[model samples]
Target: MYEQFTKPILDYSIALVMFLLLSPVILLVSILLAISHRGNPFFLQERPGKDGKIFQIIKFKTMRDLTDVNGKQLSDYERLTLMGKIVRKTSLDEIPQLLNVLKGEMSLVGPRPLLPEYWTLYSEEQRRRHDVKPGITGWAQINGRNALSWEEKFRYDLEYVDKISPRMDAKIVLVTLEKVVKRHGVNANNYMTMEAFKGNVA
Candidate 1:
């Protein structure tokens, strides 16, 4: 009942409130990233949402585009700017996603969205993570975030899907705030991001 009816109201109201409250921080980061990259500070890319629907996920652009003499893009660690590092560590990069919530493309709590290219890689069971709208944070995020292996993350995602409720979501949100405050599990094994999910995991 909560998932189908009440959650959407809560998500929209909370996101609107948060966006207004954080507008100053968002604007400040935008200007800083714009100067740092000398280009657009917003990043948008396609991610699978509810029932594997495609939607453009929005975020702050925290990496610079730099290439070697061969013109090949550098690694994520190499492309990460100082400001980017701070923003990512503090999770300010996620501030723009409030717009996604407003657009009804997401929930406040559910499975985190993943790259569209990974759709084919997921087993039928793993694909169940998309049974609900994606979230900016989720069960896996608060539990281990990028620190967890793909299998562990999927386990938590499934658990959430099978047992979603307002109480569970509220607790997840509270724990997520604490996790963000501590900057825990912001990266996988100290890397700038998690390693790409290959089909072998399934």
Candidate 2:
């Protein structure tokens, strides 16, 4: 009931209100990011949505297009700037994804979408995580985010799919807020984010 109806309504309202209230902050961040990264303020990447449909996920650009002497792209740690780090730690980088929620491409709570290429690697059970719209934050995110192993994260995601309820969603939102406020689990220890999934468990 909530997931199909009320959540969407509430998500839309929140998206609109947040976008309006944060416009000034977003604009300021955009200016700083443009000067710092010398490109658009936002980043967009294709991620699989419900039922494996594709959609463009949006966020504030936090990494530079830095290259090595051989002209190869740099790693996340290499490209992540100090200002970018601040944006990421504060989760200000995710503000743009509110537009994604507004567009019906995301929800306020569900499994965080992964790269499309990962679709091939997911087991049938793991793939069930996409049964609902992807979220800005989710059970997996609130649990440990980058701190959890890929296996654990997927388990949490599947659990969310099985037991989604307004009460559960509300709990996830609260825990996510607390985690972000403390800047906890912003990055995996010694890694910019979780290591890329390599289908190692297969």
TM-score of 1: 0.97
lDDT by candidate, in order shown: 0.93, 0.92
lDDT of 2: 0.92
lDDT of 1: 0.93
Residue pairs that clash (backbone atoms under 3 angstroms), model 2? none
Best-fitting candidate, scored by lDDT: 1
Question: How well is each residue in 1-202 modelled by candidate 2, as lDDT tens digits?
Answer: 8788998998899889989999999999999999888888789999999999999999999998889999998999999988799999999998899999999999988999899999998888889998999999999898899999999999999999999998998999899889989998899989997888877464
Candidate 2 Cα deviation (angstroms), residue 82:
1.7
lDDT of 2 at 133: 94
